[model samples]
Target: MTRSIYSFFICIIFLTAYSCKDNPKHTDDIAESPEQQLKQRYSKLVTYPLDSTAFPRSVNLKTNNLKKVPSKDWTSGFFAGNLWQIYELTGDTAYKNKAKKWTAFIEKEKFNDRTHDMGFKVFNSFGKGLKIEDDQEYKDNILMSAKTLITRYNDTVGSIRSWDFNKKRWKFPVIIDNMMNLELLFEATKISGDSIFHNIAVKHANTTLKNHFRPNNSTWHVLDYDPENGDIRMRVTHQGINDDSSWARGQAWGIYGFTMAYRYTKDQRYLDQAKATAAFFLDHPHLPEDGIPYWDFDAPNIPDEPRDVSAGAIVASALTELYAYTDNEYYLNYSKKVIHTIKSSDYILDKDIEYPFILDHSSGDWSKRSEMDEPIVYGDYYFLETLLRLKDLK
Candidate 1:
């Protein structure tokens, strides 16, 4: 009886192996395409339960739970934009309906002027909605959002203030990320035919170009200005590994932001700045073979440091745009490589995951011990953007 039982177990194992070997239709035998994986993921995400009090933010890796952020959070608009992009890419009304619902929660933020994240909060949501259909309401809300964002712009500094907190440490802080908010201003001018918005956008981009970049073209993560005389008080960082180190995401932000500014202004300087920053990032010695970067380019630990998939996603999207202007195969190939790696199982979330985040292993701010190696909403947003851009290029 003991010999029979052992033989039975061995036979079952052999049969399973044989069956899988011959079965071409087996799920494990065929890899899902990136497009298929994302569309299916979006199909389920449209029905994912919401807290009714907040929008989906990131997963709490410690608890393996979805984290819902309030509307005031800087990342509040990203979820809605994700839904809108899903609709754009798939032409699925189910996603549009969910996008509309989620976007409504962010409309009120158009008037919330306390933070410089107005574009992140308002433009990402409402601006994405406008791209699908020219709704008067979305346009108006976006214009309002642009107007509110400019309130944070100090003419003395010729840049938008990034944070309202940590006043003691920074008199007027303008982060490299603020380069992204200029989009809302540029869009506002197009919709309203107002030169004010365009002028401000140009000024902000020019100011950032002058002061944010180091002699090597790597941008300082933050610049604090005197605020009175428009002179820079200090160049520092809040989220980078150190004051002088190149924060991966901040550099990615500079790439995306400057590339975008060039699109609007036809300013060769903006294009040059974008290309220089892209070179700094793509040529960095510490960048991984897979195209994803460590949390900081200058981190002490070379291969052992945490990866920021968000930075990779951001660069993939930005480089695709840069390729359009320059016809540079290097940029296109690198961007495609990033998308390839990001689409792999190492970055894409597992099929059985409870949350709606697409990619994982994005480090938000390593120094703060916040959202490290977790799924951030912005990572998914930029990943979707890369998908859209790549589709267009094809």
Candidate 2:
């Protein structure tokens, strides 16, 4: 019996040793300092295919598969912008070199007037370049891109056309996403002292504010306008779950865009609009406790739904600006919560992996079954933007 007792005690001691190894109790293991985490995250991006033809969109985390897109794609500028932000954050010359190289490729987009994402493309690339380096050529390219973008604006429609793909099904479709493009136009007015560009941006914002928002201040993704009378024809959702649901990214765009408008124009109406839209997002019962939002707030599946880190990043960045404007602690504290949550293990990519991306699990066009639960370039771009903004606040 004494021999049996000794063996049992020995087995218990071995099991206890294994459990201690399995679960580390060190504070360092549980939490990482923000600056240390940021450096570790960006250090891996140095060798992320920084060549001319490489614009990474989404990456398959498990398989280490990257989706490279061409320069003409709307998402092309985001990766370049990400590099610029990294340089700004870390003061690394290698990232600056990569940023200059990648931003040059997007110069060809200044003449491509076929799409409404000129702001997303040119502003993110050249706009950031102008801010960082103040290159005259970058400023000139941004102005030229804004001129090309305004060509798509129809006087009768009072908004720029979003997509030409579903022409048979819709006429003059203007999406809430177009609100994002107004920043380029507004910046154009400041750079060139041209009121024409400013006027166009205001008209588009007012038109969207009047028609795009539902009764609850949740924006519809797409709105079809009568090209003849500038009247609302229909409200629809292209990338959302359904026509009636609030798409997470679309709502985020509305909040961010209007907040930016308030910044430039200092219009009380725009500020009020941003606050109302933010309320709709923050007060929504479905928003996850982690502060990362699902692809759609109203997606039928609650806990099982895919989260869009891009939307979370955008909202967090915008909220920081909103806090600055209104001196609202709620916005400031909430924004910090979002940034911290994203820095957690579940959303941040592993340090040792050569993951060509930063944040993970961003849903892109979920309805189309494309880029679901992947790390998209835009997600990384906005995540960097949010971090820089938070650092500035510090």
Candidate 3:
């Protein structure tokens, strides 16, 4: 009886393996023509309303009195950006109107007082929204936000100041994350016909290109400068395992930002930088077999360190853009690979058919005080945006 049972189990195992081998939906088959599959998936995903609220408005902001926190700003702006992308893809008035409302909310926050993230919170929320809708009010608000951002740019340091409270102590303030924010300045230049914003944006980009990016294309999160003389004082990472360690999100920001810079300036150096950074990010040993990146590339030392789906989603979205810019099949293929990996991985929350949250194990910040290892609003937004970009790409 024991021998018969063992043989039966072996037969079942063999059948299962055979079935999997013959499965038409195997990873390689699905990924072979990823762009086509991505478009199909995107059509299905975007047909459903993720949130039925007012335009530009977010369901994520239902939390109470979350004052004095950058997370609130980041989340709300990120949502607005995603909504704008949705409107662009669907051409649905509902998404466009929601984007308007959210941009108004961000405008009401008074851009003048904002610090480091004014570009992100305003550009993504207001500028990008207005670009889609062509609302004059939104355009005006974006200009105001640009002026606010310009104030943060320190002429002496040749870069933007990240935090004012650390004002007198540190200068030459540049962070890998700030690369994402520079879009505000670039957009302002186009909208307002002001070269000042462009100059500052280029200066910040040049400083980062010269200082923060490492030889291997991995980047330091923060590079402190001597306020007095604008000399490089230290290379540090605010959210990584150590100063020398590579942060996955930071690398994603670099890839996206440098590619964006290339798009704006048509500069080969920016493209080269973006490609190098992309290589380091995709080639990291710590990257999961599924193609999702951990919260930090060096996070293996920390037990149970969460992965950042936000980083992976942003990188995938940027990779799509990179593909469009370069028409490189490899970039397009990589973007699809990452998206498919996320979709198939256990991290994706598709159980809630009504509101599917794409990807999991996303960390706002594991080492610091954040919603560490939770499904972040931005992660979901970027994932959806990536799907839309895939759908629209020719």
Candidate 4:
């Protein structure tokens, strides 16, 4: 009888050990919500021993290693923003402390005028931090960053310059992704009562609305403008399949940027443009059934192409906001469907992986063969945003 009791105790110990691997906070082991699964995943990720000098960016699959970036990298703020969003969702002070630590490293980007990514770098980090708790430093830094961002805008071009390089091939290069940066300007105007920032944002958005999109509301990756006469010198692509193809992430940016424009201004044109671009994305022939899109909508290999999980995350987050404004069930349902698809084990990284990213298979720039089919920082950033938006929407 003693021997039987000992065997039973051993069995119980084995079962308890197995359950602990999934964490003590597991709600439903087999059927957890995406938010719960992501929470569990981040609980493990928050414990990784990372150095403060560099920020986590992506996993290089060839080396199977974590890729870290300095503050100057465009993706520098996403990891911190993800931590902030995580703290917002879980109410975990540990995550908040981590978020602040990482966010401090991005403040130097406030004066970084060389790149047009101030909104992406400083706004995402300090901007998100301010949302959790009001801080004068964050507010000041955000306003300064907005001041730095407008230095790239040209009144003649009616848009913000996207890149300074390739100057020989292009005169004044602007991109659809630049539309996403206008949020900083709008916010800065509201906080500082500066019309200079607001006017520049409106001009850039109007120029992008006029020139960046095709007849079908699909956006080009880049547009070259004559800096002197404001004429469109050339239409091209730096990241899409080609000059004529619609890049997945660029379209995602268009819908998001325009929707945000409508939110602040209540302009009917911006709302109409947002809806049109959104329909272009949702009704596209090449978009996958799961709502994730290929790197380019016109990529030759349809069923065999790599998917951009980041684009789907951005779209899901944008749709939640769109639904909030329009009260549209289609937008909400699509957002929920994307969350359901990507939260599965097939997309979420395994619990055993040491890399800090949450989702896998985000294609960054396939034309450059960069960050292909790998975990990216922005994918996790927008994934967290989508979760927060969906939770609030519900």
Candidate 5:
């Protein structure tokens, strides 16, 4: 009887120990440390090169058959931007050389035309590249692009003209996405001592604040106007169901862009807009338990619309920015929660190290979209950025 009682007690102890080992309080046993977690999430992203050989050198407008296409002029610039980030993280000169090569390519294809995405596809790339490399040629190319963008600015409207293809119809077609590119304009102002770029950026930001952003903090993807008259004609969403609906990626852009504006200008209004948009984004009832948002907040009556982990990652990164800007403990805590959610959720394919893609549930195209629920290059970029941001926080 004594032996039986002792054996039973030992069995119970063994079972309890096994359970504790198997079911740890933490999510992943391997991700024991923050560095380890970051490595697990972002290490694969480091392998992919941003050169033309690896990825397309330019946007394939002909192949895609879109009414509006991004110019090839911006592709190398885009790669340059990616390479700058790579250099920052890895301190690899190879990345810097590639960035230089990309800048040269962009310079060779320089277009004098002013477009809305000059900041996104060009300035963010070459301007950031110049900042990273400090090459005279790259600087010259960036200056040219900035001049083109500034030339697009209309003194009458007090904003830059976005798209010119619809020449007679839409005039100052600004977008929330352009907010991210304002850095280029500001940098140009500092470098060239030209207040024109600065003034244009401020005016565009002010216009977006007054017109594009909704009362709920969600933003329209596109804001069209009559450049000749400086009159607001229509407010539309480029990526969402309609003008009234919310697109997840657009929301993320607004969050990141407004925060960036605040950082640059220290404007209280920009900060308020950032907080409002972020609050509305976080308060969405459809946000999954993991805090990852759906592709479109109002994606219509579908049984299972795809969730965009990429958008979530973008928002997480922006949230970190917000946390830094406000130094609010609540924002920091929430940012940590978002990071934790992304790490544990299946959206991030941590197990598949062999695969190039890091996060799943990416929607490349929603209109005639090919990769509706497949992996996307930008998704990988944003996820890696999020991990890097976390590492910086640590």
Candidate 6:
């Protein structure tokens, strides 16, 4: 009886393999294209009444609920930016109407000076809107947001203040992520022909280049400066595994920031910095073969840590632009690899998934145990941006 059962199981396995090989109508044949997947996801998202000042920040893992953020939140602009990108990508009127409506919710942030995230808030939404259709209102809001951002710049420290809440521990903290905010300043210069904006951006980049990096080109997440004498007080990490460990998203921000700087200034130093930083990220031993990175490179549990899809998406977008500048096949090919990896079943959400977001399984504030293993708004934004960049490359 045992021998008969073994023979029957063997025949079944062989037939299954043969059927799979012979059938051209497998799931791949019916799977939606990436563009189709995006449209379906956004169609679901637009069904929600997100017209208030509330924006989707990330999903709550325990409750499986989408977290709504206030308009003043640092992540306020990404959802609208995602909408704008979708409109540009598919030329869908539904997306354009939603983009305009959501972008209007963020216009008040142009006068919000409490945080140094104007670039993230204004540029991601209004800046993209202006780029798409050249709305005078969008352009005006962007310029106003740039003015609010420069208010955080300290001429003495030669860097923008990253946080005001941690005042006791950090006198004048400058996070590496601040480098991304400089895009607002650069754009302001072009819009107004004001060299002050350009000068501040250059000085900030120079100061960061001098202090924010180690000998190996890995960056610290934060650098605290003494406002009194323009002296470095401390270099630390707020979101990384430790004071010395590299945060995956921080590295991505560094890569994208320097690439953007190079685009604005045509500065060889920024380009070199971008390339070296990208190498540090890609050549790291801890990076997964699938192109997604752990929450932190130095996280204690290697291979078991949560992957930050936001970091992967940001890196893919930045690498595509870097490819345009350098014409390097490595950047282009690696970015394509990342894009494919993100589109795999592990990262991309199914149309029926309860989460109304596109990408899944991003690590947000892992140390705080917040938003762990969920979809973040910025992840969706960067994923769309990466797809658009890839389309342009094609």
lDDT of each: 0.83, 0.82, 0.68, 0.83, 0.64, 0.82
Put down candidate 3 lDDT per residue, 352-389, tens digits, no spaces: 43232334567776456565566566777777677666
Which residue pairs show backbone clashes in model 2? none
| Candidate 5: stretches off by over 4 Å | 1-79, 92-94, 109-114, 166-171, 349-357
lDDT of 5 by residue, 1-394 (tens): 1222222322232342222222333343433343334334344444544344344321222244212222353332444566566665556676566656655555533455645566666665677676665666666666667777777777666667666666565666877777876777777777778787777888878877888888888999888877678788888876677779888889998998888888878999999999999888988887776777778889875338887776877787788778887877655555556556554555555444444455556765576665556555566556555545655664
For candidate 2, what is the lDDT? 0.82
Residue-wise C-alpha lDDT for candidate 1, range 126-210, written one tens digit per residue: 9999889889999999899899988988998898888988887889999999988889999999999998989998999999999
Q: How well does each candidate superpose onto the true structure, as a TM-score?
A: 0.90, 0.90, 0.79, 0.90, 0.77, 0.91
Q: What stretches of model 2 exceed 4 Å from their correct place?
A: 1-40, 62-64
Per model, state how many residue pairs clash: 0, 0, 6, 0, 0, 0
Pick the lDDT winner: 1
TM-score, cand. 3: 0.79
Candidate 3 wrongly placed segments (more than 4 Å): 1-72, 166-172, 301-304, 351-359
lDDT of each residue in 65-88, candidate 4, tens digit only: 777889988898888898999988
Report residue 272 deviation for candidate 1 (angstroms). Answer: 0.4
**Candidate 2, residue 211: lDDT:** 84
| Superposed Cα deviation of residue 109, candidate 1 (Å) | 0.6
lDDT of 6 by residue, 1-394 (tens): 1222222322232342222222223454335443454466568666657655568888865677878888899898988898889887767778888888888999999999988899898899888888888687887887888888888889999988888987889899999999988998899888888888888899999998889888888899999999988999999998888999999999999999999999999999999999999999999999898888998999999888889989988999999899999998878777767765764446776567665577787888756788777888899998888877876764
lDDT of 1 at 350: 65
Clashing pairs in 5: none
